[model samples]
Target chain A: MSARILLVEDDEKLGRQIVEHLTEAGLEASWLRDGGTALGLAPQNWALLILDLMLPGAHGLDVLKRWRSQCDVPVLVLSAKQDASVKVRALELGADDYMTKPFWPEELVARVQARLRRPVLARADRVECGAIALDVAARRVFVGGAEVELTKVEFELLQALAMRPGAAIARSWLVQNVLPPERDGTERTLDVHVSRLRKKLGTAGAQLTTVWGIGYKLKSEDVA
Target chain B: MRLATRLALTLLVTALPLTVGLVFLRERAARSAELDALVDYARGRMESGGREACEDAPEIFQDPPFRLPGDRRFGGPAPRDPLGLGRGPGGPGPDGPNAPAGAGGARPLRGRGPDFQQPPGRAEPAGPAAARFELWAYNPDFRSDNPAAPALEPALRAALERGAVLASGTFELPGRNGLPPRGGLQAVLRMAWTDGPCAIVLARRIDLPAEGSLLLARFGLPALLATLLVLVTLFAFLPFVRRVRALTAGVRRSAASGYVDPVGASGSDELTELGRAFDTAGAQVREQIERLERRERSLRAFVENTTHDVMLPLTVLQGHLVALERRAAANEVPDPSRVREAQEEAHYLGALLENLGAAARLEADELPIERHRMSLNRLIERAVGRQTTIARGKGVELVHALPGEEVEVEADVTLFERAVSNLVHNAVRYGREGGHVAVVLEVEGDEFVVRVLDDGPGVSDEELARLHERSYRTESARRRHPTGTGLGLSIAKEVCERHGFGFQLRRAEVGGLEAILRGPRAKPGGGNRSTA
Candidate 1:
């Protein structure tokens, strides 16, 4: 089930439209005219708080600031004030993310989905994709229920790709996060490790794909 | 002329003639005294028993007396009365029998008769002084049997009657005593003795010292003093002249550069004061010019920022409408997404107008925001509700999470709401599609913290730091969304600051951007607590 969003906004027409749009995108959204009503709601029940910086009763920044101390719900601030200082200030006040005014509806829905999807991914200690299963804590990989051996670099590469399946990771990011401190591996070296890891995986190696100019991605299931 | 030269010239001009006159007077006094001294010596010699030798003795005459050549008597030729007998009519010549032996009468005394011409008391008998002086005796009785008697005139007799006669004449002394016919200045004196009146004549050769040497001795020291005066004047004025020249050059440079560079001021003098004054004036002028330039630059930046802000929304709206028209012309219903996008652009244009105006008012320090203790939660609720439609159109969810208890804070309600609205709108606009935007308020001890977060493509760490700057779009930001007013966060920041709240932008652990705004928590007794 998609997580519910609590929307705090003052304009009724804009408020009604945002709720409708979010509902049509298959996410439940509830609207409030002011920070007073939103501040009474339980943050743990909602996946995200979509907040308008301007409100009629309580300032949106104030609500975000007050509620964040009590609960850990991710907050997304909506602001028509295009000044970056406002965005930075909101970010500093415990806002999880921000969008300037005049954003696409599709972009908004995608952001909501991204925020909802993070916890599901973060809770997993082991990731399984198609015929490959990775034990993240123990740093082990299994292909077709058979264990596969991997070097430290190769294992880290596979783990980084497995964390976000089907998503392309940038080469520079992978080089920064997955490579061992002493290895001093460049992207080219990373590619060599990936090839070696694929060879070790054997049939399961087909799931590892290069994303052209980007780095790499792992797929558990192939698309038709 | 240079000051030193001028000073030297002036001093020398005054001193030169004065020195010359002083030397001339000194020389005259010296010469007159010398002549008087010589006359006194002659008179003294004649009175000290030298008159007795001249009185009735031909021995004083020796064989021949030393005389200057070209001597002419006033009446015809002098009578040859060497023995004081004025009876002989012929002049004494070398052929005369009574002529003294070896009396050729025209030779210097050096090679002539040595024994006869020797003066009685002189030592060094054959030197420059050998023929220097000669003495002649005159018979005052005016009668003589000897043929070599000198004849006297009435003027001489008159001078003798007055006790003594002193006279100077140029004449040749006879070389009869082996003395040359030496031309000399003759000093003759007549005096009355015990026997009769006797006349003694003394003569010395006229070999005067060199005129150049005499002139130098008489004037050298004073000339030296005048030169010294010139030198002293030059030395004294040289430094003053150099300093004056430096001052002039500094002034010229000041004029050349429009009073930009400082003039050097050294020493505790009047010129130093002038230099200091010039430096002060120049500094003031430079500061004024710089201030003007700075003002001009800021004005230019203001205009550029205004133009950029105005054009962005218009361009976005135009682009959206064009795409919508294109879709409609292709025989399809205009997509709801396109309509919502155009509406969002129109909303952005409205916001841009409001924010730009508000920014102006803030800069002019005329924004009137009344502050009072108000419910911070209620303000956040109103802001979130205001941004809900845009958030929905963008498919971004707006959420507000707050404590059930009322979060009271001191603020201007209208401005506070606008600040909150801008933050939420920013999240809805920049967050990824289907990503969630949230408003959450937390209470930490005595502070109320409000945060807005979004799960979207967040900025780099470097970009995050610079995001607060007005209208600053990073490279990735410009590529992602080509249209934005770029004033939302800046206005929100202004409102929060005006309300004395702490504000910051940070990275969210939820993998997106976070904005934080903090203010003081209200007291439990419903009293306001100040944060700033």
Candidate 2:
């Protein structure tokens, strides 16, 4: 079955073009002319949400946040404003990724594919890297089948690094991914949480090795 | 005080003395005329009295007894004891020729009364005749010891005989017993009877006439002194008044006009000095105002260009990105190659926007770059490493030729990296396929030189001349490359300028473009490397 995406945009021509492109890319896109319809239809049966920041009825950021509060559907924001603050703000508001306007159609498709791929692992209910096993639905962690008590932030930080195992995840990217939507904290706060997670996980945490001048990356037992 | 007032003062000073002198001379003439009239009246009265007295009686040698109020008779003869007009008859009376009673009696006359007095009537009294008026006359003829006596008696006798009216004349008088020497005498002789030959002679000392000449002499000095005082006083006071007035006028004019006349030109004085000072102050104020105006205009131009020209292009670029993204989402997969081309365009557009924003910030003096001490050799290596893929993709050999030693510089790492990145990007874009691009760093004296030389279609002379101008891309660069913001060189230039470094673009020896950036060395006398 094709993934369903709710495409929210105010510009009629741009909306039609986006819908056509997504359909051709093998994704069923439900085009909505405003943020209101997109938000209303988001929980019904959509795989992901593609939102334009300049939207009618409700702002894209507001819609993204409201939908995020109710469900865990991935949201990808398309913004025309080139200011870095806007991109950073959209990403912080539970958006999986943000693409500035005038971006390549292929790049947008790539980001959407990446976002959709994220949930397939999520449905497995548990992920294991070396001795560490994270039970997704239960929000619990285990080291070699021995349950370990982990704080919510520490669990999220480990999960974010573990998801892209062997690839260096920049600290900024981890902060954007791991932090909760409404949590107001700096990127350094993420480092402290990572350190705490390392302590709690003990031997299982050793797989989370820091890549100097880049970021943190998790190594599987086979690579170790 | 103005020039007019000063001029008026000067005129008044000169006219004042002349006016006073004219008035003084008028008064002196009036006084002298009055004195001359009084003298004439006295002489007339004496002549008339002598004639009247002589005509009244002749041969009244017994000395007619005559009394006139305020008059004492003397000269010629003295009456007997009954009249007591002269000293006793043989004791120097007119009857005794040798006695010369008139001389003795003249002394009594001198002490008797005032010379003239205003009477009640307008008509004055005539002198008494010898017959009706008592006469005391003196004859110095018998006094042989007196030299002036002999000439005086004959002159008096001749006056008495010839005269119908005796006129006053001056003659010499001789001094007698116990009298001081007398050199001159004034005498008049008249007949007592018209028919008779009898005569009476009256004589007085001539020394008294000299007193009238002395009176005129006494007034001359004071008159001259008054004229000199007026002249001196006027001359001394006039210049001060003129100077004060001129100074006041100069101050008023300067205040009114808001500018001062140059000194010495106005007038050669202290006021001229004051004018020069004011003029200097005015010139300074004008110069400062001009400088402020120039600065304001420059600031205004900077703001206008950033807002209107720069922001418009950035907005357009963002819109283009949005359009491109929407096309790719509908995975019709129309053409994968076209999609890749569009993606590359979007990337270039983003870069262009960022560089434009950075350039604006630099022009507005708002860009903030963090400084760090980094080795130039390491910086060049990193920049080269990033550009290696692109250079190889273009089939261009990228080479870094440098010495082994470290070349440290104090700089903003990010901005400096960007600047070097732009230079390499330009080299790869314009370099001929399979051609070589070289980055060479060398230490010359106190400076570190980084030269980027590429074998490409080089810029023309005109393009090289204006290479650093914002948004000014050469025709050759535009023709050779399909993609560029035309702002790379400008941004690089701004960065180099901000860091106090010298940037130049010239024709290379390899017949391609050679760009150079020279900056002050971080260490003194430290041998640094040449990096390509």
Which candidate wins on lDDT?
1
TM-score of predicted chain B, candidate 1: 0.39
The positional error of residue B452 in candidate 1, measured at the CA in angstroms, is: 27
**lDDT, model 1:** 0.64
Query: What DockQ values do the models have?
Result: 0.01, 0.02
Write the residue-wise lDDT of candidate 2 on B1-532 in tens digits: 6645565566567656655675577555643432232223223323434333333432221122233342445333332333222123223334432222334433322212222221211111222111112123332221222122233355545655564345344444456565444343244544333233223344332231232344344445554665576567657767756665665676566556544342122666665666666567655755666656655654565455444554544555565555556666774444544443343344444545545455544544444554454568656765565556556656787765443245777665546756776787677666778887777766666778887878788878777876755442222222324332246676777788778889888888777788899998677344321111
Best by TM-score: 1
Model 1 docking grade: incorrect
Residue B93's C-alpha lDDT in candidate 1?
Answer: 38
Off by over 4 Å in 1: A83-85, A119-125, A136-140, A144-153, A164-186, A199-206, A219-224, B1-532
Summarize candidate 1's per-residue lDDT along B1-532 as a digit string, tens digits. 8676677778878898878887777666644443444455344434543454344354444323332333211111212323221112112232232222133322332322222333322221221212223334555554332334345445644665576656554554455465344443445555444344344444232322232454455578889888888778778778888888898788778867877756777899888998898888888887777766765664565566667766876898898889888988998888898888888877766655555555554554444565555667656765676577787888886666554356887665445666777777878888888887778776777999888888877778777766665432222112324322246777778787777888788778777778899988666666433211
Writing each residue's lDDT as its tens digit, candidate 1 over A74-180 gives 88888877454566567667776676566556557766776677535464778888888999889889988899988888888888777777665556567767787
* Candidate 2: regions farther than 4 A off: A1-224, B1-279, B324-440, B444-446, B453-512, B519-532
CA lDDT of B294 in candidate 1?
64
The DockQ score of candidate 2 comes to 0.02
